[model samples]
Target: MTETLVVDASIAVKWVVEEEGTPLALGLRHGRRFAAPELLIVECANILWKKVQRGEVSREEAKMAASLLERSDIELFGMRGLLAKATVLATDIGHPAYDCMYVCLAMSRNCRFVTADERLVRVLHQKAPREIANLCVTLEQLSAGSD
Candidate 1:
């Protein structure tokens, strides 16, 4: 199997929608496998819904993005089995469980967890147990060889 990296909704959203760090975010896709909690899909849908509401994208464009994401090569893991662990990590790190799921996945696989949420990074730096904190990285950090 290709070497794997864990990605969260924040990073995945940029794959379909142009935004800051988008180029770097797209770079992470090259020759590497990505894994994430199945909640990734719902999170992407929720983002698209918000984009449509804010007029950032057309309804048709949002649908197209959603379709493309569904067919993307990302590997999705069911969140049910992950819930309790994720919840504990979230509580321990003072971050949302949704974001913690990506970190947990990365920890399990011994790979980097890439996300666009710098707030999560700050929180991890401030509160995440060192082991898990070391697993979280921003898209730019991973892309620029700084991770």
Candidate 2:
């Protein structure tokens, strides 16, 4: 069976940048189904913008990266129905609603939400402690599975 996962912008950015977890994120793109909330595109773009501002990447490079991501096959789901659940989860976990949107989608789809956010990972394990906790997986965990 194939693996399907909800990935956040943290992971998405790694696809374009040669960051610490880039290899694991790249490994995830190999024959795996990736899904994200429509917000991911904006989040990714914002990340690229920051990189450009910090002079880590050129404006042209950021544009090229954004274009590549937009053209990628990652299925984008609308945020219409996910807002309420995300809000509730965010309040419950003391995390931002934006991050919870991906969690909600992962729960709704019954697949892991893979992320590179260490703080979110810590919160999920420490505070979530139940269904929400179960829905999230760190990049390390997913990468470890292939070994």
Candidate 3:
């Protein structure tokens, strides 16, 4: 069976930006069936908005980025039941509630959680990589077939 990948906004954001591991993010998008918590849309839009405000991206670029994200084939997991699981995950991982949502979804779905947030990965790795199991991977790692 094909592996399912749960993508976080940090990794998804690289799909549009010319970042270091953008190719890896894009490759994953094309190579696997992707899923994410519904909060991903909000997070992605907020990131684009923040980039626009910071002058890192133009208004038009932000719109395009938003559209691109909407058009991707990723399946969005609903927030139902996820909140409680996320809360527990947050406490266990010492990550913020919102960040833990991605981890929770990945665990619930039995899929890998792919991210571009190095700090989050480090925390998961340091605290209890086995707790998260084989469910966490960085965009660079995913691109390199480490996922």
Per-model tally of clashing residue pairs: 0, 0, 0
List runs of model 3 lying over 4 Å from the truth.
129-131
Model 2 lDDT tens row, 17-119:
7778998899889988999999999999999999999999999999998998998888999999999999998898899999999999998888889998878
For model 1, how does the per-residue alpha-carbon lDDT over 1-147 read when each residue is reduced to its tens digit?
667888888888899889788889888888899999898999999999999999999999999999999998899988777788889988887677888888877887788888888889879878978887888787777787876
Model 2, TM vs. native: 0.95
Best by lDDT: 2
lDDT of each: 0.86, 0.89, 0.84
Task: Give the per-residue lDDT of model 3 (tens digit) for 9-102.
Answer: 8888888866677776778766479899999999999999999999999999999989998998889989888999778777877889898888
Q: Find the 10 residues in a row with the least total lDDT in model 3.
A: 126-135
Ranking by lDDT: 2, 1, 3
Ranking by TM-score: 2, 1, 3
Please list all clashing residue pairs in model 2, or write none if there are none.
none
The CA lDDT at 9 in model 2 is 93
The C-alpha TM-scores of every prediction are 0.94, 0.95, 0.91
